[model samples]
Target: MIKTTVIALLTAASLAGVAAPAYASAFGDVSPEFRSFVADSIVADLNQKGVHATSVEEWGDLIRAYVTNDNGTQTMEFFTPGSLQPVTK
Candidate 1:
């Protein structure tokens, strides 16, 4: 699980770099584009947490995603929206 999470973070960072050609660095007052990049990365991370997850929705500081479990749908929440840490409720 740790290995998967690490890979996810690295993948997100890579995607962000590709999304923005002018990406300077990973820290300090980054651009709005960088923030958006981070958000996208977070969403991807959430999607993988629940193997059946089909969609992701961002609400304020919480990140909500839907997954189709064996019986029905399950929702996953992440309290920290832009966190590199794994999905936290």
Candidate 2:
């Protein structure tokens, strides 16, 4: 019984891990063009802010732009890339 339970749990966990990317892709597809646009905006904004942005990475429904500022490193999040609108509080 214990072995079976462990196996089942492991299988479920593995499945969940695999499904996570798919789920994220589906949600991210809401606005692929928008997301890309937003990401570009973010980079521009960061540059104006005197920050050097390395790249923009999309994970699931979130777009994270990494920047290196004079103070330190920072990450900006946007719902869609095209809008470049900051996620509302």
Candidate 3:
């Protein structure tokens, strides 16, 4: 009984891992053109604000921006999909 439970638990965990990406993708993947537009707009806007944003890309249901700081270090910032507002933890 113990062995069977362990195997079942392991199988369930494996399946969950496999399904996670598909579940996230069900949120909808934007087209290449839309992604490019978002990236370009974010880069321009952030740079204008002096954030030194290097690039941006779609990350699951959010947008991830690569930023370089004045101290010569890099960091990642996440934003909402449509509104482009920063996501707070």
Candidate number with greatest lDDT: 3
Write the residue-wise lDDT of candidate 2 on 58-86 in tens digits: 75555566766577857664444434345
lDDT of 3 by residue, 1-89 (tens): 99999977875574345423432432245667644544565576567667788997767777688989889999999876545578999
Q: Compare the candidates by TM-score and give the number of the best one.
A: 3
TM-score of each: 0.38, 0.36, 0.55
In model 1, which regions exceed 4 Å deviation? 1-13, 16-43, 74-79, 84-89
Better TM-score candidate (1, 3)? 3
Clashes of 2: 6
Q: What is the alpha-carbon RMSD of candidate 1 to the true structure?
A: 8.3
All candidates' lDDT scores?
0.52, 0.54, 0.65
Compose the digit string of candidate 1's lDDT tens values, residues 1-89: 99999997888679666533322222224667766665455455555654454554454444455556778857564433434233542
Residue clash pairs of candidate 1 = none
Task: Rank all candidate structures by their lDDT, best first, as comma-separated numbers.
Answer: 3, 2, 1
